[model samples]
Target chain A: MKLFLYLDRESVVHRLHPVTKLVALPVLFGVAMRLERLETLALLALVVVVVAALGRALDAVAGMASLLLTLLIATTLMWWLFAPQGGLLRDGFQPAALARSAGLGLRLALMVASGIVFLATTRVEDFAHGLRTLGLPYRVAFALTLAFRLVPTFVASGRAVAEAQRARGLDLDHGGLVTRMRRYTPLVVPMFLTSIRRADRLAAALETRGFGSGEKRTDLVEHRFGGRDALAAVLLVGLVAASLWGGELASQPAVQAALGSARAWLEALYAKAASRP
Target chain B: MRQRTRPGVLPGSAESLGVPRAEIARRVAECLGLVGLAGFERREPATLSGGEKQRLAIASVLAMRPSLILLDEPTTDLDPVGKGEVHAILRRLAADGLAVAVIEHETEELLDLDRILHLDAGAVRRDGPPRRLLLEVAELAAAGVEPPVAARASRWLGLAEVVREERFADEVAARGVQVERTGVRPRLATRGEAPVIEVDHLVHRYPLRDQPAVDDVSLAIRPGEFVALLGANGSGKTTLAKHLNGLLPPTSGAVRVAGHDAKKAGTAQLARHVGYVFQDPDHQIFSATVWEEMAFGPRNLGVGEDQLESRILAALEVVGLTEERDRDPFVLTKGQRQRLAVASVLATAPEILVLDEPTTGLDYNDRERMLALLADLHRRGHTVLVITHAMEVVASHCERALVMAGGKLVFDGGIPELFANDEVLARARLRAPTAWRLGRMLGLETLTPEELGAALRGGGGGNGA
Candidate 1:
């Protein structure tokens, strides 16, 4: 089974230092958090798309395309329902609520896209190497790798469990909320226990292989962070700088007016596309 | 299992490590080169073949530069090619003077070892050279270890020694045993009946793979037939089997299972007629008690409350697990857990059973029990399709064999025809089990040890008589 979104493609983004790749994640998350403007979130989404394209990981984006769209539309509509009207839907959809809800929806989608890009660009071994370099303890770094490997094991088991149950005539599709949840109950226990057992097996295998003997281990093939990695790192850092700057820029009146108009224009475009058929 | 591998050659890059980058690369290259994976440093571990992954693990341990290395069942899940690669690498390591101890159930690997330690239930039953220990077939068989084919056949032939295949022909010829190029008994299934499962030009392409997992291949299995699906890993046996139960809808062509159009039908609807048992029982067993696990399938199929108890009981009884009905499934032995998986599927009362490597990782005793259970099911008129790498199982249990390679079904015939076709066997990465080879040497078709023994005693003018 494919372990993660990590595609084994040779590309500029894929060749970046695992640590350098991971640096984008926290930075992206931070930007998404302070982001009030839908346009800024859109910028972050574009950045993710560019990175994904460079990594040859557009497939990852396309693979989860429906889910991402669903999250965007669902989160937007759902948030609009609960948006603080300062009054309710009695007044037409408030621009503030519309902006806030759309930003939230776009923000959620951007965060997931950012994650897809990071995982697609970063290899698990490189992730471990980067974590350990960042002073993540040997055992902790090893544990994280085990966790990464276990994801597929758990997924495979979960699927097998479902298929096995399905073979026994267990159908979860044709049910109400409670009925579906109840139908799913049989899957959870086995999946959980089976995953735990698999985790234990993975850990035991690592232990037997002398995972942490307190001696510094050397990699057989050392990956050199080439000039391209440095340039990619610089670009990622510049993106962070721009996001930080945007946080301060949003306080100005002119920038606020500009961001607000951009948000409204984006929402109108979305509404136009969505309302068609 | 993949945790056995490291980042490759080492755990860290050049800047973080004390060793010079050049030195580390040299070491990595040396180790990987030793294992025949010199050019695979850049390959992602996930994408490597099973045997390649095993080699990477061995190479990681090899890179550690330890004098002593140990492995437990390192080749159990690999194809014959993978197994051969691992054995070759380890033999080279042993020749280079490393103390390599391997805990393996497959007796074939022991032929290359300098010494053999025969263990029975955690106790050392015999510690001797392979030449001596391998010949003790009776004791080895009793200990639940499959004796090397040479040893078992030689013993059956009443030969005193010679436990290697190289000398098997000469040793047998000295006793006037004639070799037969073609000694296969055809056991093809009758073809008048409609197929319980049929696949026509089925193709399945995975999301990221360039090639289809199951290519445009066609086959049919008649009801009440026991069939073996044979292939190396990634050869589409599982993918093709998945189509039979509607777990995977074909990318092209059509699949018909028990008169239902698998492409159009829901998996649950098809599940009523076909039961699938996975390779690992741990993947599916979740109930606290054996009874609950057995009840799961029947309850899903909507067996009436009154008949549910009887259904569960009958399934449990069929697997000989009635005594453990109230026991926690987790506490059961691996073999028992596997049996419970079989019973769980049995509870649904599907007429067609598709088991994926049911006897893998099982000891001889458990294997025999599982085979007996399967025989019983076959006797009760259930169609069985087993996807397996075990040629011994194919030899004795299955009436017909389907061999797949590069996503294509290259051979479909009786088991004897399968063993005889070298081209299909090569493509499928299968080796004829020892019984078949021994049978060929003696000019008598044999599927099991008993069959060989009876044929030998009756045909050979033995002085022991």
Candidate 2:
């Protein structure tokens, strides 16, 4: 029932200030976005792995490993069906294109992994408070955080309604597409009603605590940025700058020769598969 | 984000319009600690119990350290246990010398409060101590407040009903109230030859829980037996009941329902023999009209047109919603919607019915109506299993009681035996019904006020039923 991904862990990354962790997310995403080769992305992936490992967030990363792998394979296959790049294959299904797509997929997966680590490290309260400090409107920040807060509740109620309908003999599994869709009516109506009721209650609960009175609010949580956070922020910005500028280092003559050999090896394997009975 | 409005300057509340962020955080934690919700800081309000939410709401206000706190019907939406929790907190707050006032309808719970202000048509009608105002039965009834059971019973017995439950029991025992004696445990009714539902060594674990939700529970419920599954919240009663209808497959051991392996059989197949009513009626009643709601279950079961009409009509008749067959179900009162939920489940014609907290959030008349409906169903040859915290309802209506604590079946026996086992009752956080206490003090095995009164007045016969 705990569908949220905020893992409770005490680690260096988790202990970092919310703004420190928040800045790391976009910086890490920038590093992943600028790199285009597996060699460079592997180093970036190592950085991610070490960060996640130190943060005790590897379990969550491992949980999504299969999903990331699927995206990698699917993106590579999809790129193979595109027009030939560099004219390396007859139908453009070449290793260069495959490597590009694989790198693109890995970049996306790494971005998502960093986002996951950020979530695992940062509580939703800190995230909202960070936004509030960053000059976002309070209502907008609350709207964003409310989704994270209410999803588990919404899902729990939906599951309850589904179970109730199943008890009443509304079999949704062994039905045709239309029948299944129709059978979901009993579950949907109740979930909708529950959400509305919850909304009404939430409004009253908020109102009673002097919410929407536009009075200045105070919080029990203090997101402090200390010397360690400043150090972390500088290191993250330098890392992003280095990764963006570091892609050219992969195109040096020696690295290009190694890449050519790997591409040749991949082409030979594709030829062998194409010629199979 | 809660606003900071200083009602009074206390340890955490500074006299300022814009409180410091650190101060607010400190005050929030301090208030939560005061209200016994220190570690539940991040829990979703939806996942919290009614009592917990009420406590959280109180903590939100208590952070202000207000000199006087006023609430309107705080326990209205809570169950007996939840109401008890709120009452205890109120008493504690009052005892702490904080001024507290509550607009309450369930007057029995607030007897310990120092004063009562009875309002009639927006005017102060009666202002006195709880002992005086609550005992004026006629005026109390006219004021639309349910006087405590001890007060009503004492009035009927011609004793000065100026009594709390403890005093009533002491007074009745002091009067040398004679009582009829039978076996130590009341005689259980003759049950069916075979149990319709059987759970053997069932252990249920959620994906993330450290301990099993239902740990090694084993019990059987026979046909035509009105059994109460009593437990504190999250004590595995609902988890055990879910196994009966094949909604939850046990992680270990086996559950057999009516001679069929529940784990192997599909839930739809199990629905043919057992129907489940959820705690909230809105979860099940989805149709626009009452008639359609009644027909939904039977239609799902593939009841032919030849029999579907009669089945739906029979169900509506049984739950007494026949006249509102075409009315929109959403427009019905909560009590009627609850009955509609029962009717919808009954439309499937299951022999065994399991209701989860059916009497919660109901007025006295609706609660009685629901109990009468269950009793009627039991009479018509249905095995009824009710998962509830209402000890009084269990004592009066159920033939047997199954008490659970910490996911273990602590006690399974007759009502009086369950109450007499103080350890089990304490483990389950259950209080015995007032009638049971009064009757026990009077040396009888009665479960209802009528029965207890009759036995106490010496009705010229022995009482055991």
Candidate 3:
């Protein structure tokens, strides 16, 4: 029923300028992607978690954990099964390949976690405002905000349509996979029609509200980069630098020793379990 | 000043057109204040209630500072309280010297307007003072507009004019028409059978809400009973009705429909007993043709082809949509689409029917037809439950009234008893039918104009016969 992911809270992360938070997402992703070490990727994920906690968006983040976990497991299994470099194990389990895939999964998880943090702390309007500030056309920014606004409306309309169909004996729950998918095919028509009608109404409403009046639009809530925003932006830049630096430092003796010891511990546990079975 | 105000040019456009920011802000605030939404400048439009959103729409229009404002059926989908609020705002706008024109089918509330332009088939049928035009009952009825009950009462009682409640009361008292206290309470014909729908301690709390949408509510509806679920917006009437059909499970309670526990029965199974008709016909309608729409329900119910064809034909005939069967559902008029929605549900052959605001956005003829259809269904032994804000519909059609307020069942009684209780009416934000109001003033408890007229002609008071 909630229309948006914008959590209304006052905290360090929430207080940062929307542009700062918006910039931090790409920065985190860019650095996390460039880094090959699992330790650095895990460290970036920890940073995202810390920021989300500071913004009191942990609840929202936690709500998404299950979906992220599914993605993680899928990506890890895909990489382990098809890894081109690592040789397969005796029983074709591919432990070394699985380890490499775990690293990739951790990197993707960090990227997704950073995106979640950014959305949870930033209001949709603020994102639009940030876009406007970033020199995007007002119409484009407005469209983005409108898209966010329509998400909840479409969700509610979809629910209503589903309920209406259900009341007429449309049993979506008790059907075969293909049958259910075919049953849902009928739902798309109504949803699309309703969405089109709503779009017409919304366009008329927007025009009546002077949406494209060719005037210099004024924002109600103005955002400025305050001291906290500046500090957060600095910290983000430092974190990105550290992550990139960690990728280079991954070949160092001590870092390699630590990674080797972690792999040893994992293999020892796997061997112990295998021997017991 | 006489230029046609094109849509899409809002007051904000003025600022974009190089108007001073201060001036635009002042105008926006003033307009919002005019619509009683002064402190809602920062509020998102989606978060507003239906009434508030309507008001905000008007405010946006008012911010344009147009000399003339036109609203098309502004109160159609709103609850009684929301309707009243919008009406008050419109009256204020008109009073402020704005040329306010409203096109609406519901005339009772608009009877106090300075002028009314009655239109039919895109032609002006009548244009005159509202009171005079409404009093011409024959012409009004010819145009498919139900004259205000007071106007009908005045015509029947030979009064010169009585559109206003106090004037009608005074005229009745002065005429010495001894309004007989018939005290005819609406009673459900007791079949003594078990109730078809039983709700006990039903409480439904939506996620992320601090309070339950449907607070602990209990009721038993017997077979063949025609009940109106009356409430203001957000009063949980729809929530409670949804529970009966198993559309929504109760947070901490139980609903039994046709001897099946609603919590246990799947909605598809519950559909056999309770058919729920949503408010917006467009939301439920998706078929390429009316026939396809009607066939959807029975097909889902897995009825045989021959029986399904029969069911579809019977439902279409009941809703008078037989001729429109081959036509695309989206191409039909709003009323036809609404009927198609009802027919689609009836195709499933439910024993209990629940319609949510079935008459909304419908013209007088369409509304009467819809109600008549429901009445016919009720006559055939289907228990009918209607969630409506139309007091006149409840007064005239339904025998029992269940009023809800603040998510609680505040009152359950006969229609006469409901109108007679001022406290309950206030709590539920419902207005008594004009006939009921006039009758109460005259110490009678009539629910409709016909009842009042009959009482007057019965020689109860020396005024009429």
Candidate 4:
């Protein structure tokens, strides 16, 4: 209920270069994208779960997983109800379709799971530093930091304004739409005015500190991409190669012939159930 | 007095009201006492004036009844009467066994405080009662807090001491530094050159306010004139200032900077002539490096790269922020950040300067430095306009003063004359300077400490001294 999931310590996952993590997450998703069999996708999901545990991001993963499960169950049920391949007899509910649904669900869940692990382990400042290292304009990087700082500030201001409004006895809870919007006028005006004023002050403060005339500037904190970055990149490349190879094998004539036979058998069973009358 | 009880109040009701523990009745009573709002029972806090609202915030906290209440520069935005009233309440709270912890930069008021906790670079530099700490003027300087009045006066007289409150009366008597009868005319500076800013029939109405913030106000400020604007909160000082540099447009009035119409010229164009330093520094700093941040305005104006560096260096020199050029603005103390804001604006090299509540949230040393910087600017012939509730700043620096109330200018005259008129100032919710107060006590009409000093040295008046 409190929704506190951003707590973690320095670990192997945390130390990996953010760019490498960014690249690796998509590669993992691509692997899931190529896999059609439910069992193989489930195995991939299991790997994600293992990685999440190793990264000490299990709590975050669990929260995402629960959300994924709810969506997956609802979507699968809806798909099954009007799936076009469904039969009238209750006894003849095809297991293959259910397997297919499981495959899709596993694929989607694993892709989301990997993303959660990556973000939970990363620090915002490191991400900004990484942007700068990757040749982003310095202004953009600093602006991102300022924007991030502004979020908490804006939230705090919002709370302060809300408290001020409540003290004034402006009841926001039981108001009409127009009244609610009107009540917000006072709060919004002050927030905007204060933010502008703050911006002005911040500008002056920054200028007075010799912010713009740097012959040379020093960074108080440093970020480095070490051995972990190399290892992670290598592993990601290997996974992509393995996934392509697996896709090639799955697309072979022999594999296709076997999958076709299984579909044919399910069709015959449905035909028999329809002919029961 | 029997403590009144509320029937079945919520567990954290006091906290919800921005006060922690006292009963609702006591909270209301405290608010009423502070604001002089009587004959109201169970009235919501939202209907109070800006000053009243601030007091209510303080009273709400008082109700929570903490043994030690931490107030962060509570009087920064308040006028004299409101500030005085709040101070009275705080004094009462202290007397009632509350260990009040106040972090403030106002030096004159420091004399009345019980204890002063001086911090420097995140470390406690000094912790003692005000009287004892006042004597360590040098040490206080190092800690970036201003010395008390007598200490400052002593410095002017070539005698400084580490004074504590118990010795205040004896030391002043012994020093033979005359406590002057107030109201004397020091040499006034000649207003030079043409008007740098001119406004005629200025009217500005914020979308929210029922009436215009600035109503048909006409004024002109010449170069090298130190002008101060005084008013109650929301009386349109800031609104009028925003129009000076084209940040805001007058609804039905004309604002011209050096004969160029501000509204017609646009903000970017007017920015070249009138450099506006915001009250807060964070809004304008959009760069990772301090060097880059300072270059923004100049870069926008298309100053040559070669010249930009020199200008920035000069600006930094003025504010004394040259050493921390690379440090993140976020990491600096509030006072330091404010100075940085000033330096950034100065880097652009505008002719006229408009500052809105520039001293708010600053510690004493920061305020003094800012005042000194303004004084230096005045000496350099830059037209400066400041909006503040602080009569001390007005007294120390300003020659001319403008008082506004209900979005109208009530009085506009010389600072001495303005403060000497009690009726006009009271109507505007502004207090006369401390010197003026002392001078009035001595039946003198002077507005500043220097004038009072002169009057006393000449043996020119009353038994009040």
Q: RMSD in angstroms, all models? A: 6.0, 6.1, 6.0, 19.0
Best by DockQ: 2
Q: Give the per-residue lDDT digits (tens) of candidate 3, residues A96-149.
A: 567778879888877887788788887776787788888999789878876887
Model 3 local distance difference test score: 0.81
lDDT of 2 by residue, A49-134 (tens): 99899889999888778988887777666655553564334454457766777777788888888888888877776787678777
List pairs with backbone clashes in candidate 1: A218-B10, A218-B11, A219-B10, A219-B11, A220-B9, A220-B10
Which rank order by DockQ, best down to worst? 2, 3, 1, 4
Candidate 4 Cα errors over 4 Å, as ranges: A1-277, B1-50, B95-99, B110-144, B150-192, B443-465
Which candidate number would show the highest lDDT if scored against the true structure?
Answer: 3
- Model 1, runs deviating above 4 Å: A1-3, A7-82, A85-90, A93-115, A128-136, A217-277, B1-22, B177-186, B442-444, B461-465
Q: Count the backbone clashes (under 3 Å) in each candidate.
A: 6, 3, 6, 36
Query: Could you give me the TM-score of model 3 versus the true structure?
Result: 0.90
Question: How would you order the candidates by TM-score, starting with the best?
Answer: 3, 2, 1, 4
Give residue B7's lDDT in candidate 4 (0 to 100): 14
lDDT of 1 by residue, A1-277 (tens): 4557877677888777777777768877887887778887888778878878888999988888998999999998877876656223545667777777888999988889878877887777778878877788866876686678666656767888888777777888897898899888778877888767766786675665556555566543236667877887788778778877857777899999999999999999999999999
iRMSD per prediction, in order: 6.6, 6.1, 7.7, 22.8
Candidate 4 is graded, for docking, as incorrect
Give the runs in model 3 whose Cα sits over 4 Å from its true position. A87-100, A246-277, B1-19, B23-25, B157-160, B459-465
Give the C-alpha miss distance for residue A50 in model 3, angstroms: 3.0
Model 3: pairs clashing at backbone N, Cα or C within 3 Å: A207-B8, A208-B8, A215-B16, A215-B17, A216-B16, B178-B461
